[model samples]
Target chain A: MSRTIAVVAAGAMGAAVGARLAARGARVVTSLDGRSEASIVRARAAGMIGVGDAELAGAEIFLSIVPPDKAVGLATRMAAAIAAARTRPVYVDLNAVSPATAREVGAIVAAAGATFVDGGIFGAPPQREGKGPAFHLCGPVGDCAAILAGHGLDAKVLEGGVGAASALKMAYAGITKGLTALGAGMILAATRHGVGGALLDELGASQPELLARLAKGIPDMLPKAYRWVPEMREIAATIGEDRPESAVYTAMAEFYAAVAADHAGEERETALLMRFFAGRG
Target chain B: MSRTIAVVAAGAMGAAVGARLAARGARVVTSLDGRSEASIVRARAAGMIGVGDAELAGAEIFLSIVPPDKAVGLATRMAAAIAAARTRPVYVDLNAVSPATAREVGAIVAAAGATFVDGGIFGAPPQREGKGPAFHLCGPVGDCAAILAGHGLDAKVLEGGVGAASALKMAYAGITKGLTALGAGMILAATRHGVGGALLDELGASQPELLARLAKGIPDMLPKAYRWVPEMREIAATIGEDRPESAVYTAMAEFYAAVAADHAGEERETALLMRFFAGRG
Candidate 1:
């Protein structure tokens, strides 16, 4: 059966995912209002039909895909559209936000007579790398991943419902992206001491694996760090206020923000890290 | 002209450096006062002459090598000996203390009419590593590196005076050891999210070098972490407050303290990290 799906905001992951479903013969629709020309083009190219609120609520499912900061606002919009049209579509949130945010979004949609499924995308979109994205799903309808798998997504239903999928994503990103900050901090600190070469050499000799990871990861993080700040904040909020581990993620948020700061506020650590790589290259 | 040297508290680094000088025919005298039996054995094995206060003051050079916490106390003792005998020895403090602490020690020694040189040791004692103990020396008499270089030590004299040598050590250690704490924090956090193996796999795939570093460094840090606590404190003090970078070193100190704490405290982080390695092996 063809699934009427509304994929909101056709960004990198969203566009690719929308395309995957459209190609699988699902009736994929999207709202590109107030979107950039680039985003509109992406949505059109992905075969996602442009829609107003009335058309949006006609879909069997509404997938929320946006930045961490925008997740709540987008879910609220979907809830209103569903309420106005007197239709109850399953709304799945796939944003990189905290569990608390997910629960809040779940309530917003539920109050609007819409079914809510919590989702956390583990890998890249299916259209990217020509592979199935690992859609870790939780909540009552969390097995929505199974439905997603029909379009070739690698769906995994977590036994722990509701916040499970979001928790998984937050924790995973906290480690992967968090590591880049750690590597950068240490490398620049070593450079300050003039033992930059010595430390790198020792790591190369004794911790060769770590040396390789830093070489790749730190450089990769430089351009994308701006986008990671809010995600780190979400990770911090998800972990809550009490645990000491909360400090680690919160510190990462500050680290990324510093890296993204302007030239006058140019982070000493960031400058040194850039210099280290520039010298190496 | 052969120089007379007094090496106080012949521990790992002290005994090794003293032996290097003694083997080259320098008169290396030491005091085992209030030292452990192990330390006495190490001092004797290094062929150092046991000395009282009068003999200590007679030496042309006195090297104070101890833990970061003990650096100031040892310097105070050296100052007293110089004051009591009314004789001056060029006192070199080579502990892994903060620059501020080093300056305080330098002042204590210099007040008694003894010349003070600041020193930072980069590598382990030759007894452990067999070579390449880059003794970075600073201060007005920093050329004191020339004296130690004769005994086959790899000594480098920086252009900067006082504080510089200690600053180098603090900054260097802040990164090397700090990175270990960061890695452990992330790895254990990932474990809490039930994605420990997943993170390890992802790291192995994308950050092979980092994966390798975490494998070795985290495990190696276990027993020695208890010792690293004070060094982290010194690094934090050296970086001081009002800078974002200082937080990294401070967090590392807390991380080490948690690891050194007992099991009842349930250092979930420490256990996960240890388990990761134990399972790997």
Candidate 2:
């Protein structure tokens, strides 16, 4: 009674999860008809079989891991694929979209008579093979938790339907990434005064406990800010019109984008962001 | 061989320092002919001897501890006393004024053939007897550090001239106090969304290090913010036209003033300010 898992649009995180599942003996198929060469290489390296549109019909689980802007379109495509299949598969829209967007995707999969699960990834993929990050899930899938646990992956079922998982990610990212932007802004402003060294020393002396945490946490978080920008914007949109804290993260995305554009030819955007803070740029 | 120490316009901090010196067997005298009864009472409690204008002419050390706006006028009055003195005393200006103002005071004292020292206090008076806060001194006065050390008080001599001691105090206060104001503003803004609890919990979970400090620091510092408003403004002026970080503290002063005005009841102002943040006001 083996189950076939179809991972659509396999990139870094999707490929990592699919690779782990395939290595653990699940039949994994990835559709790579229009993906980049880098993504194709990553999917093949994960030991996933390249499949055509018709081959996806036999999958028991269909995971959509496209960009936030494309989540609804991908969900519509997956819904059409289920309609064409001999047996419908459980469809999970794991992209970083708003709760409203998630509901739209949920309606698409529901119209096609397939189970819809809302999922979000909190951490990055493992560098090697066996270990991977937790996948938080919610929505109208009763046995998804047991299924995920059976595969040796951590999964948490949150409250509400379709939107709660995205809300948690949005709230968590707003503060962590917001603080990074704040520290960068303050440090740069202080340096312009020719008293940054003095200010840092004074902070250490007067508020040693706060300064200790800020110095350690801010620099460590800067390198990962570029990757988190889109996710932060998605979280902001999910929180909707009333939450201005979401706007704070959108501002952070702009800050990181500027940092990315400023240091174009060096390392990855994340690495260059860190180097700018360290005074290399 | 005993030296007379004159403390002009004795208030909370001035009286506290004078008392500490008096407790160590130094003769402490204060001019109290035109001062308010509250100040006279504080001077008596701090062990300062009330002296007439004539008696101030024989003192060996003169300390001007007046308001920032009144510093120059008080310096002029002290200059008349210095001119009448049988033997010149070492003059110290410990008001929260710009460096230019201190230098103006320096010119007055030097014209009367007296040694001048610029000084600033970095913390509140001791709650109990026989203890004092850190005091910083600058300007050309031989063994000023040794004289302060002899009084059993925490004192340091900054080498960067008259402005350095004030600059150090200003820079230190700006960050420690500025961050507290920033935290309060953000927390209040988040409360508008009716999800402050969720936001705080998320902050604690994602950024435990920063959130822990903000919770403890902001609440403790808000009550004392009223007393700091005047000094912060003086610091802002002392940093002069080039430093924009100074404006942050000036903005905090305005915020504290608004909170203070809203909490106008003499007996319940502190409690009322806390209630405002708790959303009960």
Candidate 3:
């Protein structure tokens, strides 16, 4: 039996996820309300039917796949819409947020009589050749991964509830993206010291593997720096308040914010970093 | 002609450096005023002739190689002693300190009629391997690297004066030790989330190079974590005041402080991290 699924956003991952399910005979639905033209086009291309927030109650599963900052707010709004409904679909949040945020989302959706699944998506869209993109699932509502997996999307059920998948995500991203932030910070600091080029050369000569990672990571991260600021803060909070270790990610937040502004304005630092790495490449 | 030189503290690196000089026919002197029996033993083994603070003024060069906290104070005390001398030695500040502190030391020594050199040492003690441990030199008195190089030390003269070598050291150390701190912090953060074992596996599978680096770094760092706390703080100060990047090192300072204490107490995080990486290795 084909399941009727409602995907909240039709951005790259959301649309690709919908396309995967739609190909496998599932009826995919999305709300195009207040979305950009590109998003609408993507949703349509992914074979998603446009629906209203009020109509979201008709679906079997609701997957939230928006920016980190919008994760909670969207859940709140949807919970409100579903409050008067007799039947509520399971609401799954698959955003890059902290465990604390996931629990908050859990509380909201549960209050509305909708099951909440904490999810963390790790990997590219489902179009890749080998293996499905791992959509790590957790919480009381989490076995939803099994449903998505049955539909050809790679879904994984993590053992711990609510915060587990997100905790895994936060820790993983803290290393991957956090390394990028550290590399960029070092590059900027080295540049300030006038040994920027020499440092790169020296790193290549000795720490070849690290230099290679930086070379690949910097270009991949530049355009996405704006999106990463809040993600870093989420990572910081995930590290928790009791320990000062969280400040490393907090520092990363500022680093990304500065780079984001530079990338947006095409400033000198932006031009230099991109050109330096691209040239080296 | 063989030169008369004095090493301020006969600690590990200092004793080793003095031994290298003493082995090469330099008259190596040290002050054993308030050192431990172990330090006195090491100094004697290194062939360092014991001298008073008054006698230190008689040497051609006096190298300051204590901990960062003690770097400035040692310089001040030595400045007072050397001030009464007819011919004061070059009081080169060679501690792991910030450029600002290096500059402060420079002022102190210059007021005492002694030339000040800023130096940063890289690599293990001299008796180890093929290449000599590099002593990177800067500032007016920095040309003294030549004197050390003449006696088997690998001394390199950098272009910038005073703060340049220390700045280079800070930048270099921030990347090297800073990366170690970041790695340990992430490891600890991951452990808190209950996916610690999974993370190590995932990292080994995905980021093998980084995992390899961590495997090498953590064990090497665990025992030395206490010594590194102040170094992290110095690196933080070296990142300067305006930028928030310093906080990353500040966080590292705290992280290392915790790990150091854990190592001393043989606590769980310490045991787990050391065992995990050791088992992996």
Using TM-score as the measure, which candidate wins?
Answer: 3
Model 3 lDDT per residue over B1-281, tens place:
77999997999889999998898899999999889998899999999989998888878998888888888899889887889887888887777788888999999889989988888876667783455567878888545888888877887777677887777677767777777777777777767887676567667766788888888888888888898899989888877757777788888789889889988996778777775675431
**CA lDDT, candidate 2, residue A59:** 85
Native-to-model Cα distance after best TM-score fit, residue B38 in candidate 1, in Å:
5.0
Model 2 regions more than 4 Å off: A6-12, A31-45, A48-59, A62-79, A86-89, A93-98, A104-114, A124-134, A199-224, A232-247, A265-281, B1-211, B217-281
State the weakest 10-residue window (summed lDDT) of model 3 chain B. Answer: B272-281
CAPRI quality band, candidate 1: acceptable
Can you write out model 1's per-residue Cα lDDT over B1-281, one digit (the tens) per residue? 67788988798788998888888878899998778998899989998888887789778888888878888887777677797765678888888888789899988988988889988887557763366577777787644678788766777776466777787777656656666776676566556655566556555654565567678878777766766778887886776565565665666676677776733366665667877766531
Model number with the top lDDT: 3
Q: Which one wins by lDDT: 2 or 3?
A: 3
Estimated TM-score for each candidate: 0.76, 0.59, 0.85
Report the lDDT tens digits of candidate 1 across residue range A175-272.
Answer: 66766776676566556555565456545654455567677778667766777788988887766656555666677777777777832365565667
Model 2 over residues B69-137: C-alpha lDDT tens digits?
677787777777777777887777777666667888889888977788887666666545544666678
Candidate 1 chain A — worst ten consecutive residues by lDDT sum? A262-271
Question: Could you report the DockQ of all the candidates, in the order they appear?
Answer: 0.25, 0.12, 0.48
Q: What is the C-alpha RMSD of each candidate to the true structure, in Å?
A: 5.0, 7.8, 3.7
Relative to the unseen true structure, what is the C-alpha lDDT of residue A207 in candidate 1, on a scale of 0 to 100?
47
- Candidate 2 matches the true fold with a TM-score of 0.59
